[model samples]
Target: MILVIDNYDSFTFNLVQYLGELRSDIHVVKNDELSFAEVEALHPTHMVISPGPGLPQKAGMSLKLIEHFYQKFPILGVCLGHQAMAMVFGGSLKQAPTLFHGKTSRIYHEGKGILKNVENPFCAMRYHSWIIDHEKPIHSDIETIAYTEDNIPMAIQHKKYFVFGVQFHPESILTPEGKKILKNFLEISYDKAHPLH
Candidate 1:
């Protein structure tokens, strides 16, 4: 199960529909109305935070909730979600190098397993003005997974937790191997479903 937290009608609606096509068992909550009480009650297997229009300071600003759940479950943060994750984890965000309102942007940095095999790391639909920039002294556990030519925090993973984030919306059409990335996330949470020794 995946609890998608956000306030966008298009991204939420499209994600709900897209995940259905990608996998039969995948479940998503289409609204950001998930109260801490609500999320605690449900105890979903995975959580994916979707993108929104405005900056984090002006947007929903659910940092406490983001922090709470991130400690409890594996999370995949997209665009705005990515920024939110960085902020809550002691990172900062600022306006992008330029207003990149396009269908794709190249991730020129190196990556590992989840991002492997993609010819280009271009996400399909993104409309944001801000990007994440980690603080000088970042948490040691967090490893940067993706970045642009100028080196923005495109994706990151904690060494100890199942938590992961991407500054781009992999569910969108422009991402060449988007589904595979999601598959990697699903696989991470799968371990929780069946713990090993």
Candidate 2:
């Protein structure tokens, strides 16, 4: 099962639909409405933090969820969720060099983890005003995996956990390889949940 924490964003359902294509059991709850006890009951194999408005700090339960479940389950954070993951891991956020609402950009990645087998410089949809601050030192545990042409961080993953974040909206129609990205994430989640002996 997969749990999706909706951060009051219009794009949350779009992301859920994309996930549904690859998984049948998915539950979605608003960031503000979810309780830890309920999450404990769901026992999701993977957690997806949906993109939303405002700063990651104000994302309600989403931030707490990342702090609590990052080590327990596979996590995929998108946009605001991405920022929240970075913030929890000693990373900081700053206004992007330019706003990228409903825009597209080229993404260069390390071709590992969720990006494995993905194109090196793929086009992805962007819809964010804030980005992980590259000027400051990122947490040692947080490994940046992808970036834009301007060197803005595009994707990140934890060095020792199954936690991942992406600044781009892989659910958007503008992103051609959106399904592949989500598929890769699901594969990673499956491997973590059922590791080979």
Candidate 3:
């Protein structure tokens, strides 16, 4: 089952529709007004923390839900969703060094986890005015995997958990290969990652 926290109503509604198209077997829960426990009672296997147009990295809203999901399922965050992960941990979000409000011009892909055997040189949708500082230490377990061509953090994953966060909108069609990337994460689990050789 897949759970998506309700944040921005318009964007989220469309994103939910996309997920349904991707996999019918996937179940989606629109968790608005439901307590974290109420949400937990549903027992979601894969969870997505929905993005919002709100302030960057809030301190309180849904911290319990985020912690709960991060501890248990394969979680993905988009836009504000990305900021929440950083802030919930020890990290934070700030006004973009340069505002990326629509689409990023240059993005170079590297590393090989879910992106392995995938093409290099790709672009992704941009919706937020904030960015995650990869150089900063959020959590000891945090590792930067993808970054902007100007040298800014774009994606990251927890060192041990199934927690993953992407600064871009993979659900958007603007991201040329976004859907494929999402599928890869769905199939790849943290258990499959090999220890450093």
Scored by CA lDDT, what does every candidate get? 0.67, 0.90, 0.68
lDDT of 2 by residue, 26-145 (tens): 999999897889999998989999999999889989889999988888899999999999999999999987999889999999887788878879999999999999889878989889
- Give candidate 3 misplaced runs (Cα > 4 Å): 25-32, 56-61, 189-197
- Return whichever of 1 and 2 wins on lDDT: 2
* Residue-level lDDT tens digits of model 3 in 4-116: 77674456766677777676655444445667776678777667777677754342344556776676767877777777778778886667877777766545556544454
Ranking of candidates on lDDT, top first: 2, 3, 1
Runs in model 2 deviating more than 4 A are 190-197
Best by lDDT: 2
Please state the error at residue 28 of candidate 3 in Å.
Answer: 4.9
Winner on TM-score between 1 and 3 is 3
Off by over 4 Å in 1: 25-32, 116-125, 134-137, 190-197
Global local distance difference test of model 2: 0.90
TM-score of 1: 0.82
